[model samples]
Target: MGSAVNDFAGEFDKQRFQTVDDACKLVLKHFYMAKVDLKAAYRSVRISKKLPFRSKLAPGIFHKLSQAVRRMMSRRGFTIVAYLDDFFICERTKKRCAQALAVLIALLRKLGFCISWSKVTDPCQKIVFLGVEIDSTTLETRLPISKLTDLKSELAEFLLRKHASKKQLQSLAGKLNWASAVVRGGRVFLRRIINGIMRLKQDWHKLRMPGEILQDIKWWHDFMSTFNGKSFFLAKVPITSVVTDACKSGAGGFYHSDWFYVNWVEDYPFATQLHINELEVFSVALAVKRWAQNWRGKRIIVYCDKAATVSCMIQ
Candidate 1:
């Protein structure tokens, strides 16, 4: 059953769960939050014996069942998000939180879903959700320390091995990707490893360990070791708009004030022989660097024409 779920029903996850960033934003906007993990979430669902587990239709059937839970909670006054069996509830007050929890548990029980008693956190307490630690009081979010420790342990074991197999390297890259989500400027740190993995041509176990890879691993560990919790503070400054554009001649952008005043029009220098995509990215980078102080500890939207640049910013 587990193998079938992993191989064929895995895509069901994408349909039901919001992005981690979205989930964090929802939690931050509310006051009280609770995270609950459904015990044996998938096992609780009974499949029809008429259909084979490996069939493509089986995933959709399971996904529909999960969707039913989401729909039931939608009418309630609080925010409830579910990724498979894990449900996160966010409400304004302790009273509303307790009410939301009671409603959720009752609905799940009514639907024949078993609850993980130990994992059902108190609604009034600060909780970790979607692998990121969130403090309900301050609305700050950070990569969990325990996750970093586990990653380091896995890397330590891999470092001692003479050679890493393809699967091992892939797993390490995944762990790094997860850590990079909440770490500012972390994806750039991962570029070398991602490029190295893509260039593999030799047998999995026969490939030698690259010195560059080792250096990168060390750097990653040291950076994470010193990490104090990074806060995502609420926006206090009112930003108007930041528009970015690039041309063969130069790259530049202009930011407007919330009052519709033209703060400045920036004409930035650019290197020769750069492609369109590079220039597009450079324009946004320059604008951010120029206004870093003005926008520090504030939320702002960056508008750009290039889809590739926007996608990179999102990742």
Candidate 2:
């Protein structure tokens, strides 16, 4: 029902969590942040009589309503970062933060919205919003301890099972998707699980968990166990540019004055079987492997002629 109703609503310009991260960067150090939650957010908004469904919340329609709230808040000059019903008010000082929070609460009340007072946080240097902990003092975002522990526990349970129902896999995928907002390169690891979900024919179907899926789960579990989950808000400027290309016989790339090339051996198994797109990706991979050490802790832009390769890498 959601999928069908969402089509009529079209695409939404919803604010991403990354935007919050970026907002944190602008006010790094000694900033106060507080979160305000709207009580029963979607239910608070009235549905139009013109719409077909009137009882439950339609995500698409709700999003449009949320955007109006965001624009109103922006026009009022509140430094707010919002995702749906969650709003994080950012300010340079505790006093200003408190003032903004007070005014926001009053304004929202006047607008016929109820605040979840228990969920509201006072102005502080750090606050948890949308499950991600944002620290203004350190200018970093991370999954809170509770979220990390829960994720690890779930993954551990999956490791003991030989298979999982489609619903179970989908639930886990959603959690991982949320956690990926703070975990670097986390989405890359989710490809296998997402692919598995796509292959399911029914919600009750059981997927025999593959070795690769188990490996990914284990990797996530181990990583979270020790990782602090901190992702800094500092943006790295690209210092190096790489141009890469590939042919049927070989692949080559150059960075600055240095160059590297690899020639496919006569017995190369994929020489005749791989498509040009695959070779293009391989060329970029080779380039990274060749110079990753030098580029460590810095950013680099890669130039690839193949649009397919670029799209694949972006994903």
Candidate 3:
């Protein structure tokens, strides 16, 4: 599901369940559940030229998507009230939920609608949708423990209160800009995508939906296509170390964010955008190596806005 659609589904999840953690957790909480989705959801919808181009092929895809939605409304005797293919059926028994799932899946299939089996949840007490946790009994998806952990990390310096050398935002502007510079850049698209990532940064503010996750997966896939061995973006520059941080940026401007991978440093392709900070860090890392060639012990301190790059030190 896309981010916008995920938002609606996420709301349903919170209203239906108490909390959302992971898909596995969801299965454990709900006695019986069903995840119904329209097959080929994006492809099925007929695109309208009026819809401006969003993603790479979103325009044409959405054009067909509109048609699919129309067909869904007229042919299936059901309209996508969720604005997507997710339909909720309340039942007391597993048999009923399974029946619902089977019926919904088959019905969409018959209408030539495709669904993402990977995303579908089958009869569970604990389920997560759009990063929201659901508890069937309480049906109030609240924030998880991990969100607190993430908030701690982002606000580490801010919470420290020492604030001696880092008083001005300009001195720390590099850190502030790190995440957005690389992730929100032109093609690299440092946005959160919900496809493959396993966990969040422990901050609800950093939550991502399907759109960011999907974009991330595409970038990685394209990255693999572009290279065979370990791809490096900066080679000529001397090696140096720097700390990196990243986050998403929106109209709210709560934190400095950009769409990026958890392991952005190693995973990002060499061909992708070479942010100034990344280049600086690369220069330092390389320069240190060159300088330490004759020495046995060498210490390096690297900081960055890119979580992936910074994660390297921890790993």
Candidate 4:
């Protein structure tokens, strides 16, 4: 019955459930914050008017129905970031934060939504929301020490194994993906694991560990051992721009007043094969390699003529 509903249910808008990253973005700059957890959130919604036969909320439709809660919160002019039933309220001042929290609680109670006071937190400079420790004082987010310890143990156990089921690989991938939110540059290390998961033919298959996958896992294990799982919000403005172009014969790019051009040898395999998109991407890569040292610790905007090259970079 659950599978049938999930399979046939209409698609819900992604915006219906605010993402953790988006929530973090909203509260990162605020000095004061609080958390509100709605008790029995799904059960609190009365579904009789929408589905007379069903008394409980179906998992598929809950998010869509929960849009009402978000709308109500927004209409009240509160600076609250909500992910499903959990709400994080942020303000620049303590007084404002307190007022906002009080008003939010009263509103929820008046609307018949139960607030779990035991789980709710008062306004403060630091609070754990959705498993990530958000510290307004430091302007940073971190994975709690307990989560880091558990992740390290899991990675160690996985490394000792020669083969693992597809489910195990997927579970580990999910954990790494979540951890990436608080660990800068962590996503770059996940490519091999994700590729390995894609190659698996069945859930029950115990696939042998690949060298690349093992290398990536080993890197994670070593890096996490000395690394503090904290990421500071940085400004994203591009510090420089590079314009690149490529043709069948050659590829070239310019960084500011400096420019570079490379002509493909007559016997070059890719150029002879007419791999224009590959050459276009290669032009950007070459430019980065040549000028990376000068652009370290800063963002660079790359302009390419081919849409294919841009799409590849985006992915």
Q: Pick the candidate with the highest TM-score.
A: 2
Predicted candidate 3 versus true structure: per-residue lDDT over 7-26, tens digit per residue: 33222211222111222232
Which regions of candidate 4 deviate over 4 angstroms?
Answer: 1-16, 28-30, 46-60, 188-219, 236-242, 246-276, 282-301
Ranking by lDDT: 2, 4, 1, 3
Ranking of models by TM-score: 2, 4, 1, 3
Worst 10 residues of 2 by lDDT: 1-10
Q: Give the per-residue Cα lDDT of candidate 2 at 182.
A: 81
What would the TM-scores of all predictions be?
0.74, 0.78, 0.32, 0.74
Candidate 2 per-residue lDDT, tens place, 187-223, comes to 8888899999988856788999999998988888888
1 or 2, greater by lDDT: 2
Candidate 4, residues 101-172, lDDT tens digits: the string is 998888878878899989899999888888888887787888988889999999999889899888899999
lDDT of each: 0.70, 0.78, 0.40, 0.78
Measured with C-alpha atoms, the lDDT of residue 216 in candidate 4 is 87
lDDT of 2: 0.78
| Tens digits of lDDT, candidate 1, 173-248 | 8888777657666776677777667666432634467877777777777786677646674465557588888767
